[model samples]
Target: MLEGHPWFQLEVLAASGKSAGNKYRDAANWILEEEMPEEVGNKQVEQIDSKIFENAGIKLIFSALPADVARSVEPELASSGLFVFSNASAFRMAEDVPLLIADINGDHLALVEQQQKSRPGYIVTNPNCSVIGLASGLKPLADNFGLKSVFVTTYQALSGAGYPGVPSMDIMGNIVPYIHDEEEKVEEECDKILGKFTGEAIEPLQLNVIASCARVGVRNGHLESVLVELETDATIDDIKNAFTEYKGNKDEALPTAPEQLIIVTEDESRPQPVFDSYNGSPERARGMAVTVGRLKLRGSKLRFFLLVHNTIRGASGCSIMNAELAKIRGYI
Candidate 1:
């Protein structure tokens, strides 16, 4: 995605082990079917060293580092005067750091400026994968109707665990009821994303967010069954209008910003991962939108199923969108 961006280029690739100093195409092959395109495939993979940032004129670091590694490396990269757009969990809930969902809380990116006062540069992060869908679905409703409480159950995909994700014996035909740290992350991050950012820090949204996450057998999109009770009474049509009418950050023209934030559907069985996973627009922003379906309402309470492409709207693509918004707003 970095290489394909008009303003960005895949200047350098970094890795450890034998893959280092080799072509990116020849690096780790975790997904056998998705070959690295020759365009970026030919770039040489280098060791993860600070020297490369200056030597290659790299201004941004799009990190998909594991949380344990990010806990150490990300601060160093940010201190080296490089903007780090991380998908890792480290620093996400930092009182000073911004757990940003570009469209939802672009204002939180302002936290980077304050962070830069202490560190040489800044680290801005997208939220946990599951929180992405949950937050996106909740934003419009929270904004228009005001949230009383949110009860969400996630049917997460296999790829969310990363390549070679769940072992065949444990997840091939079964549904695992829990994912380590996922539920807690969802509850905490949801409050932050839906919260109001005070100038000094975020005032977490004061609402009950009950989340239950599970790993299912699907390959891509993360599916959510959401039951929300709004503070204000509304009809099902009002909720649908809130979703389909949501236009948070699209007007900014960020490269990865989807033309529509959410797509509301009427089909009862429509949001299954296979046919409804990739629902965004303008080609460049495909899979960046959330698909909401099976919406049911009872007075102030509403229920719906939402699907988000975990890798796109949730992780890497969200990281990229944050960078684009940062660049436009001069935060980078």
Candidate 2:
């Protein structure tokens, strides 16, 4: 997004110590080849150490580090007055940290002020990849009809495990029914993301969420089968219109914000990875939209399937948009 934005600039690329000579190095090289300018192609990946905090030119740090590594460096970076937008699970549920989704909860950015009380720099996080899509798909419904409870079964993409993930022998023809703490992350993060941010603290929504996460062989999009119980009565048209007319972040003017934050389809077999994986508009926002299909309503219950680009909308793109929202909200 920085590459396409007019106000921001990409200045540095850093990596963890263990990434040396690994796929992380190769992936950085690939990004340089495809996105970086010729003059910046030779820029080396710096170590994620204390010295990086001393770089005055660096104001914001975007981290894709594992939870442990992020937990180690993020506090130090924040103490040194550098804003950190992380994709790790380290500080996501902290009282002051905002688990942001840019469009869905831009207002939650206010929580950073609480962090600023202790340090000049603060940490903000994007929700887990699976939670992002599910929360996004549920946001409009929660707003329009009021969600009572949600049950979801996720068919998450392999890319969510990161580069060189899921050995072929293990995942080639198999669907792993469990993914460590994925189910818990989805259930908890959703409530937080959909919560009300009081002036002093976040009030998590009381709605119950049950999730079952499975790692599928798919390469990109994460697809979920969701059943929602609404608090009020609504027709099928009401639910579909909630999605179609939903414009959570479309007006944000962020380079990475999608034209449609949520796309509702009438087709019976849609929101599929093959055709809808990269759904988004305005070139820069590709792979940033959540696609929802197979909408069905029975009494107060609503059912549908949703898809999200796990690595993009669920991770990096989420951080980028959060930063953009921060900038717009003057929290940067």
Candidate 3:
């Protein structure tokens, strides 16, 4: 979608290994072949020859490969001097590497200068799906009001499990209690995305994160119930002001960016997957903004419910926005 921005026109030079197919490749092909034309018939999107990006100038590469597969391809792309923004889990925890949520920590890009030691590639990884929603919602609080810890229960979407995802028979009318390594990823990634960068390395926030993950029947969006422990004193009104009055790069009116990063709702039974999943502006709330509702204050802790588009903002949309931010900062 960043490539579709008013100022940016992208000619995708893409290829994939001979196999069933990858989730990213499948989705990109859908955008390139079906969705783009229906959305904007005048705009032209073409697929270039494989070697064109190698010989011709190329700005950046977004890797959606599985973690291990990304490890090998990333070096080659970087060796070619292409900036990489990866959604894969590989290198996410690297000391010198950056785990970015453009809204949360674009400063982490400063560490890109250190990529010279590794294949001339600078990689930035987006956090786990569950973490993306939690991190973005907490970022504003962490910046203005201090966040000390968070406990979340994620009702994740099936797509996060990947293509041929879960068996229908198992999930048709059921909810699975556990997802392998998912809780760990959510626990670790939230801190990383909300962490502090020391110029050369990132020190994840001291916020203690505990998570419980479940697989739900929803086709899109991950909904989380969060309990945040705050250090400084704050009231329900203060938290509401922080979220409702929020504006971001999307708000400042970046073409592909969402207008708000967080949306706080007063409706007690709000942020339901089927109901609010598609709310908000064209690109802003299409699962991009972290929808927070059911705010309640108990002592120093603030509790709320959140919903985020898993495949878009949490996954592909977040990656696209990061690339756009990098372009804005000239990192691409």
- RMSD to the true structure for each prediction, in A, is 1.3, 2.3, 3.9
TM-score for predicted model 3 compared with the true structure: 0.87
- What are the runs in model 1 whose C-alpha is more than 4 Å off? 30-35
Top lDDT: which candidate number? 1
For model 2, how does the per-residue alpha-carbon lDDT over 1-332 read when each residue is reduced to its tens digit? Answer: 55646766767777866543343335363521245455345556667754664663788888888899898889998998889999999999999999999989888999999999999999999999999999999999999989888999999898898878888998988999999999989889998999999887899997779999999999889999999999998998888888888888665688788988889887888989879988999788989999999988888988899999998899989999999999987888
- In order of listing, the candidates' clash counts read 0, 0, 1
Q: What global local distance difference test value does model 3 have?
A: 0.75
Q: Candidate 3 on 1-332: residue-level lDDT in tens?
A: 54445654554535454322333333343422225443333333333232456665665777788887788877677777777888998888887777887777878877777886765657878888888888878877787788878899999888788877899998999999899888888888877777778878778787778999999998878999999888899888888888866565442344545666687777889988877665556654366777889988999999889998787787877777777777777676
* lDDT accuracy of residue 291 in candidate 2: 96
Better of 2 and 3 by TM-score: 2
Summing lDDT over every window of 10 consecutive residues in candidate 3, give the lowest-scoring window: 41-50
Q: For model 2, what is the C-alpha lDDT against the true structure?
A: 0.87
Candidate 1: lDDT of 51? 82
Q: What TM-score would every model get versus the actual structure?
A: 0.97, 0.94, 0.87
Error of 3 at 142 (Å): 1.8
